[model samples]
Target chain A: EAGVTQSPRYAVLQEGQAVSFWCDPISGHDTLYWYQQPRDQGPQLLVYFRDEAVIDNSQLPSDRFSAVRPKGTNSTLKIQSAKQGDTATYLCASRGQGSNERLFFGHGTKLSVL
Target chain B: GDQVKQSPSALSLQEGTNSALRCNFSIATTTVQWFLQNPRGSLMNLFYLVPGTKENGRLKSTFNSKESYSTLHIRDAQLEDSGTYFCAAERASSFSKLVFGQGTSLSVVP
Candidate 1:
């Protein structure tokens, strides 16, 4: 089976610029998640969706970061007015709706804000 | 606030050796998962447990709910096994949300 797919494996942006990351989750998966991983740190959940409906986004920076999983299959995470500190890897993951399902992660979009 | 603690923050092993990584949780977790983030920024799922044991290849993992801890053992470590190992605790009642540990950085030297 093909794993999750992400676009722009690497991205470089300047402060105050904008960038968008895209993800195509595994087929037959109903749950999608977006995580941010800083250097030398673990992945931190930013948001998640269940069939086009956002399940959680409390950790997301509402002011500049936004995500949408429209059609419940593909997702896009955008950051507006990016800050230097916003540079980090953006990971997308998907899992089945059943219990104890393992998440399949994409290679991730590595963003570097200069 | 739900916390997952991973031990042996950093470790180095020689080829053909073995090592074990652990995670202790303070939350009401119903399941656990182990992942290895390779150098290319890919997370490979190694094991998923629900208070039991599972083994694959040279990797074995055990989750003990009674003790609120989970363990992952890598046998006959190889250069390909060098990476950051992370354990995530999942709460059944929390709608599949996961809390990840800080991760254990492992290095295998030949």
Candidate 2:
């Protein structure tokens, strides 16, 4: 079985540019999450979805970051007018519908904003 | 304040040795999960626990919700064990999100 998959393993963008990261979650998984990891830090939750509805996004920067899981399977996280501080790895993970289920993570997209 | 605090931000261990990593949570959590991010930047699940201990090969993890802490032990460490270890907790208030610790970078040398 394939794990969670993400596209554009790496991205380099100038400040004020825009970029979109895509994620394809595991099969039959009901929960998908997007996390941001700066260098030397652990993954921080940005947003999450159960099916097609967002669970929580309070930690996300509403002014620039937006995420959507339209079909409940694939997800997209877009950053509008990225800044140098946005340089970090975007990780995607998915888990089954259970309190004890472990998360399956994807090969994150490393973004660098100049 | 850090909701999840990891101990010994970095560590160096010789092959075949053993070491333990710890995470203390400030938030009330019910479950905990441990992951290892390899050099290639892929997060691999190591253990998931609900106030109990689980062992897999040379890796063991224990979660103590009452104490608001968790631990990951790597025994007989190998070169392939070199990576960053993270401990995440599922808060009692949150629906199903994990609050991760800063992480413990482990390097196993020959």
Candidate 3:
């Protein structure tokens, strides 16, 4: 089966610029998650969705970061005003509905804010 | 304080050798998942556990819910096994949400 797909494998932006990352989850997967992984660190959850509804986004930076999964299949995460601290890899993952399902991740978009 | 902490932040091993990585959780976790982030930055699921042990080829993992720790063992390490290993835990109160460790970077040299 094809795994999760993400566009723009890399992104470079200046401070205060805007950028968006897209993710296409695996078919039939019910859960989608967006994570931020800084260099030398593990992935940190930014937001997640079950279908079209957001399940959790408490860790998301409400001021500049926003995410949406309109059709419940594809998702987009946007950064209104990027900061240097935003320099990290943006990873997208999906999981099935099984009780003990494993997560599948995309190649990830490496973002650099200078 | 970190909710999940991984030991041996970085390790270098010779091919054909064996090494083990560990993760300790501060929260009450019910399930654990291990992943390897390759050089190209792809998170590959290696094992998912619930208080027991699972083995795949030369890799083995065990999770102890009572002690709130998990371990990943790599045997006969290969160059292809070089990557960053991460262990994430699902809290008892949070079903799908996972808290990740800082990760252990492993490099296998031939």
Candidate 4:
């Protein structure tokens, strides 16, 4: 019954640098999500996947942000050429297929782009 | 415009007091979920609702899909209750996509 796990608790990089955040979702969960939370704000959806296929990513900054859940188990979100506005917490969450299943979140990776 | 709006952007409550947070959805939503983001930056699931009421310990939540709104009530608040509370909604036209409110910052002090 392990919860969603995200790696690299924190990351600091200069503008234009690249960084990647990883997430290992709970076992048996089929849906995974990535969210961005700015300081003092609620999380905003960046992307999500149902198994290995992306469900939606319209809110993502396609030019710089890319996400992959290749095997449908673990996921990675990458930011290319990070900007100061990218300084926020990246959160990973997972949910089961059941209609009533609740979403579980990870501790999140706090990113600071200077 | 915010699809999900939370009232009283910030609040302060003395320990043992009671308070409530609310979210009003401008979109057609089928379900609602509430979460507590602690100071350390961990998001904890508080309640998930589908047009009904539920209670856990000193907390209670009610979601009225017909009115497109949800509420979270905290009773006998403790210091541990200090954090930001967020409410998310699942649109009736879209499944598995959750839109979150700006959040209500709650500070419970002794």
lDDT, each prediction = 0.92, 0.94, 0.94, 0.95
Q: Higher lDDT: candidate 3 or 4? A: 4
List of chain A TM-scores, every candidate: 0.98, 0.98, 0.98, 0.99
For candidate 1, the C-alpha RMSD (Å) to the true structure equals 1.2
* Candidate 2 per-residue lDDT over residues A1-114, each given as its tens digit: 988999999999999999999999999999999999999888999999999999999999999999999999999999999999999999999999866689989999999999
DockQ of 2: 0.91
Better of 1 and 4 by lDDT: 4
Against the true structure, what is each candidate's TM-score? Answer: 0.97, 0.97, 0.97, 0.98
Question: For residues B1-110, what per-residue lDDT tens digits would candidate 4 score against the true structure?
Answer: 39999988999999999999999999999989999999998999999899899999999999998888899999999999999999999888879998899999999999
TM-score of chain B of 1: 0.96
Pairwise TM-score winner, candidates 1 and 4: 4
Runs in model 2 with CA error above 4 Å? none
lDDT of 3 by residue, B1-110 (tens): 39999999999999999989999999999999999988987889999898999999999999999999999999999999999999999889977898899999999998
Which prediction has more favorable lDDT, 1 or 2? 2
DockQ values per model: 0.80, 0.91, 0.86, 0.86
Please provide, for model 4 over A13-73, each residue's C-alpha lDDT reduced to its tens digit, 9 standing for 90 to 100. Answer: 9999999999999999999999999998889999999999999999999999999999999
Candidate 4 chain A, poorest ten consecutive residues by summed lDDT: A95-104
* Candidate number 2, chain A TM-score: 0.98
Which DockQ-derived CAPRI band holds candidate 3? Answer: high
Q: After superposition, how far is residue B93 of candidate 1 from its true place, in Å?
A: 3.6
Q: Against the true structure, candidate 2 has what lDDT?
A: 0.94
- What shift in Å separates residue B16 of candidate 3 from its native position after superposition? 1.2
lDDT of 3 at B20: 94
